[model samples]
Target chain A: MLKLQGIRAGYGRIEVLHGIECTVGDGEIVTVVGANGAGKSTLLKTVSGILGIWSGTIELGSTAIHKKSVERIASLGVVQIPEGRQLFGPLTVEENLELGGYAKRRSGRKAHAKLEEVYELFPRLRERRRQQAGTLSGGEQQMLAIGRALMAEPRVLLLDEPSMGLAPLIVKEIFTILGELNQRGLGMLLVEQDARLALSLAHRGLVLERGTVVLEDTGQALLNNPDVQAIYFGQHGGRRDSRTESA
Target chain B: MTFEQLLQYVASGLTNGSIYALTALGFTLIYNATDIINFAQGEFVMLGGLSAVSLHEAGAPLPVAFAGAVLTVTVVGILFELLAIRPLLRSGVLTQIIVTVGASLAFRTGALMIWGRDARPLPSFSGETPVRLLGATFNRQTIWVFGLTLVIVVALQLFYRRTLTGKAVRACSINPMAARLMGVSYSRVVLLSFAVSAAISAAGGVMITPASFMSYASGSLIGLKGFAAAILGGLGNPLGAVIGGLLLGIIEALSVGLLPGGSSGYKDGVAFLILVLVLFARPQGLMGGRIVDKA
Candidate 1:
């Protein structure tokens, strides 16, 4: 399990996360939902070691990871798919995936095998293997981002706003892929703006407000919670919208 | 100018251009990795030539002296990175550039203190025989310069395209945060770039020192020429740097040959003239695009 205790982190002189505590267990999906500036992304950055915690302990299984560098944290199996799908723009899709596989320091044969698996998961990437990553569509870029992270063979994946800017149909496809990966024993800690969809797919969900966790419950119970429905699911519980959008 | 004279000038221009291209490439390598124009790049060349001269004077064979010089300069380049750049990694780009300028000054002064003010000579790898080609007579060292530049360019292309480590360096240049997330140590890339860049420039120095004598103060002028070439080609593009160097060298040589009355004195001015015109006319250079691509 990846566990955090009293995590406090922020940009210099401005605290974004205040005493946040969370846990992502083996083979589980934990989704965090919040409005903008609620420290959702900050939480993930701290865990991935992209942002240092002011005071807290980040432990992956029995290993203390707070002092580890970003590369070290990633090599220890906590990989992050950063916001905006930060692909190397001028590089080909295959090159981007190949670089991701470099994190593990495995043999060329193993990296090739991993490349094949990534291509299997995202068939479009295989078709566009030689194409520059910057030319891909928003949804395709998101898939490539996830595919890149998977190349690392992470024990726990931290995703930030994977559904942002993507069409509903594409989001559904991506979430389905995420569910399949979770089913195959990959642990995910997801941050999403779409609360209903994230809660539905997640095993457990948390409601964050301004850097603090306001609520934590099982996915089913969070979906049923009146407060969660009122704020996150809208006044009508989004019944008039698509099923994925509504609670 | 007579055709043969023009040809001779072209030959000499090409030799100088090769050296400038190598120095510009060193500039490009560091610029791509850290966005700093390493002002000390030409100092590596100077160090290489002088080191080889001293080692050869100490009774080492020409090839061994050349190798030792390159190795020594490579170590200096790495030390420069570890001592000068690593501490300022978190600082602003402008500050880092200023540090490189300071480093260039320090390197020049240090060279003066060590090697004194006299211009020194290094024996050519092969005996100094004049080779004639297409009505142009040139020293044998010119061929070595051309051959080494071609080899380095090809080797660099293969490294960037075919090797995983080279791709990792490219990845870091594109997006350092993403590279870090992917387990690439950013500092290592910086160190590697400095080492490779220094070694390349040192090779250029070793090749060209026999053609023209080297002094402690020679680095500043060559450094300016290299910087001019880099700007002319487009600052971040490696191939462009090579082309720019050759073009600048030829233009400068042609000016010396064609202009009337003591125009040789104005040869250095020609490089800056092109630099000014290029900066005003097309700052992105001939091969440079809207997007900056680094090797």
Candidate 2:
């Protein structure tokens, strides 16, 4: 489980995340949907200790990790699959995955075992294990990014825009994999721009607006909310105008 | 030129090439890890040679002297990182560059104070006998320089390809933030890079000093050549750096062998000319691709 209370963070003198509180429970997928520049990525960075928290507490199962080093936080099992699928472009897919298991590298066989599990999950990665990460297609790169995070054997996986730049069919495939992993009890905190897709996969959802949590409810509840539909799903319930009406 | 003469030039060129390659390798390692060109890289070689000479003069055995020189330079590298580099990391690339240039000046000044202005010679690792090959004779030290450089380069390649820490460092080079997300400590990798760079450069300094006498000021030209090699090979690629150094040396040697009278004096100029052409024609160098920082 992960919890953030009264979290405030920013870049330089410009504050972005202003007094936010959120939680993701064990084995649950909590989706946070927000418009561009809504401080979603900043929140994840703060939790992962990549950015310093201005105020508030972030905890994983009651142990405060807000002050920990980025590496220490990752070793404690909070790993992030950052935005844009930041795989090492020059390195092979296997090498990128090996780096993901860096924290556990000294554990010897355990690390290798985890690597095997990752290979099993993404068989395409095994086939192109020697291929440079940059050469992979967008969907495959996303898979490698997620697979790299899984190599860490994370307790809570923080994903930022896993569906961004991915085709609709690939997005469906990735979400299906996420669902399957969730059934295996892997906790995920997903920040997504595709509100419909994210909400459909999540058990609970929160709507963020202007660095603040504007709404929180069950995924179905938020999906059915008129205001949510109006903003996220687009005009007229995201349906095309009828021919007679247009005429 | 006769075949023997050509072989002689190549053999001599390879000796100098190995030294430049070693120093360039240092540049590549530190640059890859921290994205900072450590101008003090040549100073590590100077420090290594000077320390070994000082130790040898102090009556320590040759092997012991060599180890002391490497260890001393390694400490200097770490201290440089702690005292000079670490503080400037957040101050942007320009600041880091200025600080490294300043650090090299300080290192040179310190070496002057310690070793003074006179160029000093190091005894060859083996007997002073010239080994005869194909009607050409070369110093035994040439074999040592070439052999040792080959061993170090191969070992370094293995380190980058086979070791987890090495892969993590490569990951850092490619994407520091993504490496951090994977629990790889960026600072630690940078520190290790500095240490290894210093050690390799120091070894070069020690090995090359026997052939070319070393003074406190010797590092400036050597460092420049090494920097040129790194740039020629594509800055961050280690294998490229080695090949670049060798190519630069062979070209310089060939110019001396084939060019008209007094052209040897223009050897350094030729190296820089190549560097200028590389910057103009292909700034990425031979092996360098455009590195996209996705993180």
**Clash count per candidate:** 0, 0
Per-candidate interface DockQ score: 0.82, 0.84
lDDT of 1: 0.89
lDDT of candidate 1 over B1-295, digit per residue (tens) = 7788888888888889999998988898888898888988889989989899999999999899999999999999999999998898788777788998899899989999999999999877788778988877887888888888899989998998888889998898889999999999988998999999999899888888998989998888888899999999998888999999888888888888778884689998999999999989998987883355432
**Could you give candidate 2's per-residue lDDT for residues A1-247 as a string of tens digits?**
7999999999989989988999999998998887777788888899899999999999999899999999999999999999999999989998998988888775578777887899899999999999999999999999999999988889999999998787889989999999999999999999987888898889999888889999999999999988888777754212122222335
CAPRI-style class, candidate 2: high
- Please state every model's RMSD to the true fold in angstroms: 3.2, 3.4
- Looking only at chain B, model 2 earns a TM-score of 0.96
Which pairs clash (backbone N, Cα, C closer than 3 Å) in model 1?
Answer: none
lDDT of 1 by residue, A66-127 (tens): 99999999989999999888999899999999888877876668888999999999999999
Task: Give candidate 2 misplaced runs (Cα > 4 Å).
Answer: A106-108, A235-247, B289-295
* Poorest 10 consecutive residues by lDDT, candidate 1 chain B: B286-295
lDDT of 2 by residue, B39-74 (tens): 888899899999999999999988899999999999
lDDT of 1 at B102: 96
Single out the weakest 10-residue window by summed lDDT for candidate 2 chain A: A236-245
The C-alpha stretches of model 1 lying farther than 4 A from their native spots are: A235-247, B1-3, B289-295
